[model samples]
Target: MAAHKIAHASYRGPSVVKEILYGISLGLLAGGLWKMHHWNNQRRTREFYDLLEKGEISVVVEEE
Candidate 1:
């Protein structure tokens, strides 16, 4: 059998600045989403407590 040679493919794409900027923007977007979710959770918890104070909802506990 004869030996065969394979060529390596080296493809270059976007610039470093563009890639860095894209990464930064994605990070900021994810952070903002996480913050929004956290704030919403806090607001919901506050509202639940307010409802509890007003006796709009009740929790039943069983003791043995």
Candidate 2:
């Protein structure tokens, strides 16, 4: 039987820097998406209230 030799892998500094940059970019993308979602919700809420104030929509109130 013959024995085989295995080679070891080494880490490089540029790869580490690239990984850090990718993490930062992903974090920024998530934050941007969150901000956009919140902004859209606020805009929709404001429009709803405006329509209600203008009597464009009807609401039913009950007396207790």
Candidate 3:
């Protein structure tokens, strides 16, 4: 059997600043989305409760 020769792998990765920037960008994007979802949910919940309080809508139970 012949001996197999091994090859060296030389690859340059991204810089620290580039990695940090990417991390910050992804974090900001996620935070913004989360905040937006939370705000929309809160607003909807408040509106629902307000409508209920104002007698605009109500829960109904029927006897069966």
Best TM-score among the predictions, by candidate number: 3
For each candidate in turn, the TM-score is 0.68, 0.67, 0.74
lDDT of 3 by residue, 15-60 (tens): 9999999999999999999999999999999999999999889877
lDDT of each: 0.93, 0.91, 0.94
lDDT of 2 by residue, 1-64 (tens): 7888878787644787888999999999999999999999999999999999998886877579
Q: After superposition, how far is residue 4 of candidate 2 from its true place, in Å?
A: 14
Q: Give stretches of model 2 more than 4 Å off.
A: 1-14, 61-64
CA lDDT, candidate 3, residue 57: 90
Off by over 4 Å in 1: 1-13, 61-64
Model 1, position 37: C-alpha lDDT score: 100
Residues 5-61 of candidate 1: C-alpha lDDT, one tens digit per residue: 889887888799999999999999999999999999999999999999998887766
Report the poorest 10 consecutive residues by lDDT, candidate 1.
55-64
- After best superposition, candidate 3 residue 38: deviation in angstroms? 0.2
Q: What is the lDDT of residue 2 in candidate 3?
A: 100
Q: Which candidate tops lDDT?
A: 3
**lDDT winner, 2 or 3:** 3
Output the lDDT of residue 34, model 2: 100
